[model samples]
Target: MMDIEKLQLHPAYRVVSDDLRQRIVRGEIQPGEPLPTESDLASRFGVHRSTIREGLRQLEQDGLVRRQGKKLLVAVPRNSDLASAAERALRMHQVTFGDVWQVASALEPLCAELAAQRITEAELAALALNIEQTAAHVAHGRSVVASTIEFQSLVAEATRNQALQLARAPVSLLMRAGYAAIAPALPQSGERLLEAHRHVFEALRQHDVEAAVGWTRKHLLDYRRGCEFAGLDLDLPIPLAMPADGPPK
Candidate 1:
């Protein structure tokens, strides 16, 4: 016979946190609005103030709540935050380069196509500056992988679509790692990267959607070629370095 009392129960704090999380997710508590006071939450949940604090802490860790002065507010997580979380999940699962490349190839061209239609003058200036810097890096015999990553990021930003920005961020992160791996082995890869970026920038500046998409597709294909030149096994899990404090710029 099984003992009914043998099962362990969840902590009171977790129960409170779960309930509050559901409320926030349901939009009962709107972002940027102050949450109930600790005293009020404790009383409503029939738990101790410490339990309420613990619950709120959990919410904060999950990026659902943030402290403002002495008050706690429901927070909308940023796209960068979501991307970082996705990056961590991918790293933990040992996602392969092929997996990342497939998604990137599909999404990046779309991003370029949309950016050609949506890009503003300010974004075009940024892309021009990025290409100049990338060319300088390449000419100086410096590693242009970081600049290349920024170039791609600028193009994505030019799209002005928050959904596309978030969707492609993890793929971009993985591609940066792939580029870093290949750039050292294939010296001409840097020059090729610069040329591709320049072509993409010109297409966007001219608002030529077909040209933008075509150039971006060619650029992505070059990435695979670079990997092959470097003798990188695409089927192997792509190694993930711990990212810096914020998302790619």
Candidate 2:
């Protein structure tokens, strides 16, 4: 391996980091797999060990790796992991959850309103598929939370703006995770939840933007109320890292 002094000017660190991240995302480096030793990495990148160390540290902070004694291993991807990174990005740029929620809430009603006017037969079929899956989950004594989120994601997709889709990406991801944690505590379930989506779907089918907007707003507000009723701490500095399933305590 090259000595530390020679490593300072090399551009390989970023190359190696990006490649490793791509591999991780592609599952080439599967979760729980051990990474090559620092010495091995140093040789592969033709850099000093210190550069590898720095790159590894960055990956760890991104929730991509963990050190155990002398070994470094990949970590399982978690929604909270993404949420934590998003939180840091938001704070570093002086963003707040309330600010984001306000914007998200505003955008969503409009998305639903537009979707009401623009939904195609294919989109309606997709919504029906999601609703059927959701009902199946409920019948199986499982939370339909993920299917609910998928339904919203489909609605968002119907909006057809790359900027809106990109902006809503992280919010939808993290919110779904948070919702799964508290879904079991909701006062209504089964027919009630099913009926809610069915009504929204029907409104979209009829191209009723006004009804869509009103009902969409009510749906989101109901979710917030459910979070409160379940005693979830939405204001936590870190996104609430909830278990994959069950009501939060």
Candidate 3:
């Protein structure tokens, strides 16, 4: 008792890509394994070679397949790659600064807690180097926005949680843009940010889960305060570019 009548057919190239995409996701095909040649794929899919090209192009755009020399290999997408796609989608959907802050406020503290328990010595060392560089940048009155983003990214990476890492990537990228706008106007923000990073870094090194969680939460709250002081409206979308009139405030 289905109400379905006539069904629309998908394009042949789309059909071919969907079939191969399933194999990749299901691990019938694995990362670093070369896909069959276009001729072989065309024969298997019963499509023309040009159709195979079109199908493969979809996978390439999705970051599911990559080319090495002349061969296409199944590939793992980088977090940045995934974030760029997600950021584009979110911006198009008019996701506001408040939306990103809510997600970050939750995810970033969780990341700090996990990192406190699981972070490696090498990661701690990297964070120390980052803090040192960030201090130098702040001292010279250089923009600390990039360093702010990198510090958050390092904390997320140290958690050794792939799912959490992916969840925070877009927010981290978004913060870069938002910080650039506000950091210029708020002089003390950079020093305060460095202090927060150091506190969180120390907590992670000590494996103090409570302290790590507390410091990260405080840091995120400070970011919210900075936004308000800079006159940014949290309800407005982080635009794809500076608005024709001016940035949203």
Candidate 4:
């Protein structure tokens, strides 16, 4: 009576994909388990195999499924992988520097506190090496922006909290991008960055939670000052700077 036949319908492939996605999310299909063959899915859903292919493609894009040779499998995506994707989306949405910095200020200190308690010897050694490299880079008057980013990532990894690592990654990326944008004009900021990193590294290595948290908070504050010195406008949306070869890591 309401022109039912005139209503537009969603493609059959999307419907198939949504159904499969729900199954996967509900654990009907476990990670690392092979999906039914496209032919089987086509038969079961009363659709063409091509439609099943299209549906699987959507799941792949969403990081729910992966191909292992000739078979598709339910895949558990890594937190880092998911974070990288989120960072890209944030860039596309024109997230601002202030928006990122506010999140970092809250999460970073907690990450440091946890890392001080949980970091392994290997991670501590890595942090030490990073500090040495950053010192050398600053001494030679080279840009330490990349090293700075890596150092923070190492600290986050040391925390061993998957949720924290994932949540803070985009903020870390934004902080590095902001520094890269302004570091050229603020040469003295390199020394300050190096000092802050060293303090945080020392606290982490010693497993001093209070010191680690305090140093990390201080470092983040210093970053804000550096941005101000460089005259970066926090209110403006952060600029997206993708690598020449591929997407931002």
Candidate 5:
């Protein structure tokens, strides 16, 4: 029996996003379908246009909708850039990078521990592949923060826990933004970051749960130290308008 009270719903938009999301998930809406316009949604929901917009924004942040020029189309799931987009929205609401780090500290190490115990060979290989890709990014002088997130995401998937997956869904937005902010702080972070990941990956490969958890903790703490060293105040609310293009680290 399902727990009715535990059913998820968006707080601000509630039924609107819930119903739409359900349709999308259940295959009623189908992928690549264009969503109705705001006016149409407003009429269907019997709410003001503002309510529809809010719901759309939430969906957009969740990687469920895409904006093509001015048209809002139903997006394919798990957008590569949705994490960045969602983080931007949260910053708009004055959510800070510190808030994100706190959540990462709480959840990610446990994710690593579980992955050590439960990860399959295929998942482990996927993690290794992500690391290899990150190495290429580093070689090209690109910041590997996005690649790092992808690697961590593979860890989460290796856990094979749907609840964990759902729990992580929203927090991923903050992580993407925090990564952008922190990438510039470390000098030649690629080698250091890659080594750290190698340690964590090897631990998982050997099913060393304690080592995986410990390495994950050290990695996250090290990242926090870098942010602090860069004079970014984690305690203060992060401003939304972070400059996207900065001098390469």
Candidate 6:
């Protein structure tokens, strides 16, 4: 017979959260639905109320539950929030600019291609506004890096595929870490970014899949070239620092 393995007991709070999280994921608990009272949960789980509270806190941080006044409601993790979590994980792992770009190049052109078919007028207007702001930033000699990154976010949102939107968000966040560092050495980058964004926006407006994808690919290539031009080592890890609250809005 095989020897019995040593028991490694997990925390009670983790056990509680794990059980509750499964229930929420399995749809037994639903979005906008209030969780049971803490006292009730403690009784059900045969744990102290403090234990239950700790467990619930984990769920809150996981974005599986939210507070509505005194009630805890089940919630879906927004793509943006999920992306922030992913960005943090990436930072901890010392993800490189090349790592980000490799994934982004795969996702971004596809995002624009999908948006050409699925984009809404509001999203188109958003992209237009981004380009407008980018142009202004360029004219005023202000950094356009953030606006360029935001334009990518807007394009990803326009795709309306939650999976794609969430997947691309963190990549965009990582790109910002590099963009801010490279901008000073590449003064013409802002105008180049504005031109690329405008071209893609027009393609999206005309529902031109090829042009949209083409311009997006060119734009991605431009980024790699910019990094090279700036003498940046693509292998260098992006800065681990993020905004205090999370990735920039």
Q: What TM-score would every model get versus the actual structure? A: 0.85, 0.62, 0.89, 0.86, 0.67, 0.90
Query: Where is model 5 poorest over a 10-residue stretch in terms of lDDT?
Result: 240-249
lDDT of 2 by residue, 38-93 (tens): 99999988889988888887788788888889988999645456654764566456
> Please, what are the lDDT tens digits per residue for candidate 6 over residues 136-203?
99999998867887899988888889888888898897888667655777888888888888899999
Flag clash pairs in model 2. none
Clashes of each: 0, 0, 0, 0, 0, 0
Query: Please, what are the lDDT tens digits per residue for candidate 1 over residues 1-249?
Result: 865776688999999999999999999999999999999999999999999999999999779999999999999887667787888789779998789999999999999999999999999998888888888888899877677777778889988888999999877877776787777688898888888888899899999999999999999999998877777788877665635321111
Model 4 residue runs over 4 Å out of place are 1-11, 139-141, 240-249
Best by lDDT: 3
How do these models rank on lDDT, best leading? 3, 6, 1, 4, 5, 2
Error of 5 at 11 (Å): 18
Q: What is the per-residue lDDT of model 5 for residues 1-249, given as tens digits with 9 covering 90 to 100?
A: 865676564555767888898888888887778888899989988999889899888788778888987778786766346455655667678776688788888789889988998999899889989889988987888888668877888898888886775466456645555566556766666777888999999999999999999999998887787777766678766655545633213
Q: In model 1, which regions exceed 4 Å deviation?
A: 1-13, 48-51, 240-249
Question: What clash pairs does model 4 have?
Answer: none
For model 4 the TM-score comes to 0.86
Sequence-dependent TM-score of model 5: 0.67
Better of 2 and 5 by lDDT: 5
Residue 216, candidate 6: Cα error in Å is 0.9
Better of 4 and 5 by lDDT: 4
Q: Which stretches of candidate 5 lie over 4 Å from their true place?
A: 1-89, 241-249
CA RMSD (A), model 1 = 4.0
